[model samples]
Target: MPLPTGSSQPVYYVGWDVGGWNCDANPASRDALVVLDDALNLVGTPWRGNLRTTLNEARDSRDLIDRLLGLCRHQAQGAEHVVMAIDTPLALPRALLALARGDAVSALGRSQENPYLYRETERWLFQRGITPLSPIKDMIGSQATKGMHLLARFAPHIAACGQWLSDDRTLTVVEGYPSPAKRSPAFAALRQRVNMPATLETMLHQPTPKQQDIQDAWLCALLAWSLRHAAQSVAWPPDSMPAEEGWIFVPVDSLTPPV
Candidate 1:
């Protein structure tokens, strides 16, 4: 069964504040995940930690992913119509040349400051004035690799899946950057509080420093919800999206100053 378009099924969202194995900032290192229901409520406890630790040995990464899959699948609404938004670089950079539409994961060369080795969506984000981290830099450092692994592991789970991606009524996954999106004026006016739907108590329960990830993850989930129902224009057409290079969904109004 697929996610219901009618009001029968409840829609859910997930935000993942991804990191690397050595990410000492959070207890989860490179894997902080949060889920929210249609009412913008946190579904359950946010998951933190590196699967490579407990699931050590061969297939540790796979096991970690399987565990995550279970979490998503378990929380899935009728037909499992969940939108998981991840704060990470979903694809490797696409080739710069006009015709090299081949998989850029193993493409021509590397870039230092730019995302040419990151993904076409990074360049698009730059054009839109949302500067993103250098996926190439993270690639060497071990961050982007985890995101890519998750993407690869989760691609098959997308309902009515697209070629290497999905954005249908069933299950859709999007790349989101909650930090920059939150910087928009719409979010800047908040006083004495983190700009998230999550509770302050919940934020404090986890490591103080990692609260940012919780916020980011929730924001990503919110972005997915918005993309699905409200401003669908926030995300580009799946056809226009890169086949191998994943697309990042940013709020249309959050992109820049209002005219």
Candidate 2:
């Protein structure tokens, strides 16, 4: 489908979280998107859906990415400067790429090197003109590791989307938190500081398997909005930020799963 066209806006951003049973799954199982205005308020309900297939087939990831891009294009039909933050790694640093090609398990180990590799991979994407954010640096500490179960299944889909997209500058993929702890301090702090509406409570209470994906998507969308308007901090550098990168949106998250 063609991207929607309408009145122009100062900035538009979309955040995404791709869900799957494994990194190598044929099709992504669940996905979420959040659309936001330049102000960064909750502009709309987070767009939640699934790919309707598995990522097992080689073409599965490609098809899923097309659908995802379509969703972003459709949602942000009128805005200028679209930014996306995804919950998967967009690009691998050369070192980790070598390890991934060698023993995947060894690279997946919960070690400083592993996360450094991941961070470097993200920085590499930034240098290449792709806006890639590392949720690990923002949320999880260095020692934390991504669960193999999750990474092995989802990584391929993320990789596929990164490879298929031609303009890395326009397509941003950011690592995001997989799931938030219920009633946790972080959740409360986010709500209190952001003044998130009560409607989001329902999302937190829902029992759906994709709850985490939905919430994270919303958060990514918020970041996208911030990137457009907010100045850079040490934690969030303007040049490294997704908004500075491109027009399309994607959300990524560190592999660290919630305990």
The deviation in Å at residue 41 for candidate 1 is 1.8
Error of 1 at 70 (Å): 7.5
* Least well predicted 10-residue stretch by lDDT in candidate 2: 141-150
lDDT of 1 by residue, 78-117 (tens): 3444667778776665553323664343434335334455
Residue 129 lDDT in candidate 1: 69
**lDDT value, residue 112 of candidate 2:** 36
Cα lDDT computed for each candidate against the true fold: 0.56, 0.42
Return the clash pairs for model 1, or none. 19-30, 28-49, 93-118, 93-119
* Clash number for candidate 2: 31
In order of listing, the candidates' clash counts read 4, 31
Q: Could you give the C-alpha RMSD of every candidate to the true structure, in order shown?
A: 6.4, 10.6
